[model samples]
Target chain A: MTNQEDQFYITKILEGDSSYYTHLVNRYKNLVYSIVLRMLKNEDDAHEVAQDVFVKVYTSLASFKGDAKFSTWIYKIAYHKCLDALKKKKRNFDTVSIDATYEIGIDQVENGLGQLETAERKEIINKAILSLKEDYAAILTLYYFEELSLKEITKVVGGTLDNVKIKLYRGRKMLFGILKKQLDPETLAIYERGTK
Target chain B: MKEEQNKEMEALSKKLFKEVELQSPDSNFEFKVMEQISSLPIPGSMAKYKAPFSKWVIPITIITLIGSILLILLFGTGNQYDIMSKLPSFNFEAISSPLQRIPKTVIFAMLALAVLLFAQIPILKVTFKNRWH
Candidate 1:
């Protein structure tokens, strides 16, 4: 969405018309919810966290300076909230090691996944993301899911662009190792086709 | 050996990263967020205009400060002569002497103290007066 349109909705919401938030919620709900679900690895926790994320965004909307995109700002909030929920649940993230059983399930999951096959890949991808160190996972989520440029990701994550690049490099390496365990040769071929 | 091996690994890594995409939530998700938000206390509910307690606190503090100063001035010092007169060697002349009646040192100290104390009253009153009707 354009900056001008965001400012318009902001003004309306600030003027005691909170229903204006529904438009923003509709626009980014999927993006926000996906990030939360991926990080928490539970639908119930993800749903609760997603609702809290939007409420926080609504309350803090007046402070939204246009320094970054609206999506970037909202994802920053969603990302933090999701991580907080994950910590509350006491999930582990010390070091990531992949299990080969994930490899066996790939063939079975591939046929049943249908159009959601990509989504199933996302679920596995989320496990990989959650296994990463907190700071590295944050950088990867902001970069890949939010589709933010390094400069924009720097502003959102409050890190130097060089740090963002280094973390992305490390995150991709770690993710590759994790995904290789879950992805069969067919999916790996499909992934290759996209890059080609 | 190292150069060819590194290039192949890079190709494989990028291939894996591209295979994943985001999964959308179940269809009922939006309705659930809406329901949750609706049940929350309305945003800005705490922002209603009212005279803050801090506003009243400022005046009350000023008044208490000034009142304590005035009470100290009124009651802090009393007649030393009256107490001293009860002593056997205390002469009526010593007690009733012109010097005793009004000491320049005492008068100067009282006047100076009163001037300083009274000086603060106007500034305090002016600040407190503005706070209320």
Candidate 2:
């Protein structure tokens, strides 16, 4: 729904037609879920945290000020919830070493993925995205998947536009490195079985 | 040659990233979140007027108030009495007896309210600090 429609629903809900909030929950749940999922990387944890994000959004809806798009605001909430959960678990994104990477020759790196079915390739990319540092994964998700403007992402991620740009640039490179590693021949042969 | 390889990699990454759509959760995820939201007692701020006055209202109110004060200070000498006389007055004599009749229960309630307000002092301090800073 449009931001105008979001405002309408918000006003209606505030005016005591609380059911209109269902429209908002429906509109943003996936956007919330995907951001949380990419950061947390566990389906159950992601689902729980996604629910928390919506609850936080609903509870804080009155403070939303309309200074940003409703989507950006909700994304900011989801990002924070993920961060809080990670902090609580004392779990940092484990950055695998470049040596840990599966070093396929350059041709094999691109060509093996090229030969895969669309579904297999998508799985490869999804796995690669999840393999990056949590911050990088989140940046990539916001930029590439959610299609937020860099400024919007900076608001969500809390940094300067230059910081977001640098992260986005580095995030793409890291994602590529992960994808290159995962597309090695043995891994491709395994995925060719239509497994994992 | 390096530039050509970089261009090719950029193209491939773009194609792959674009293919990654925002993934949907389980079919019932929206219902699940709404269920939780529904369970939480709607906060007082969620009430209609607790919905903020239009953001413009604050600046406008301040400006109008300041303008009125300035108008009175500079040019309202003759009209000051008129504006003062125009203010609606309460018939407090009727209210005074009933107010005196308020029971010990209400006195206790007032004490409780005072305690609550005292409790809120730190919160108010933080709120003002954040607002001004």
Winning candidate number (DockQ): 2
When summed lDDT is taken over every stretch of 10 residues in candidate 2 chain B, the lowest stretch is B79-88
Docking class of 2: acceptable
lDDT of 1 by residue, A29-79 (tens): 877876776567667887788888988987777677777788889888987
TM-scores, all models, native as reference? 0.57, 0.66
RMSD of 1: 13.2
Decoy 2 TM-score against native: 0.66
Which parts of model 2 have CA positions greater than 4 angstroms off?
A97-108, A186-196, B1-10, B43-133
**TM-score for model 1?**
0.57
Tell me how far the alpha carbon of residue A3 in candidate 1 is from the true structure, in angstroms, after superposition. Answer: 2.7
Query: Which 10 consecutive residues of model 1 chain B have the lowest summed lDDT?
Result: B45-54
Worst 10 residues of 2 chain A by lDDT: A96-105
The candidates' interface RMSDs, in order, read 6.1, 5.2
Off by over 4 Å in 1: A94-135, A183-196, B1-19, B39-133
What's the CA error at residue B105 for candidate 2, in Å? 15
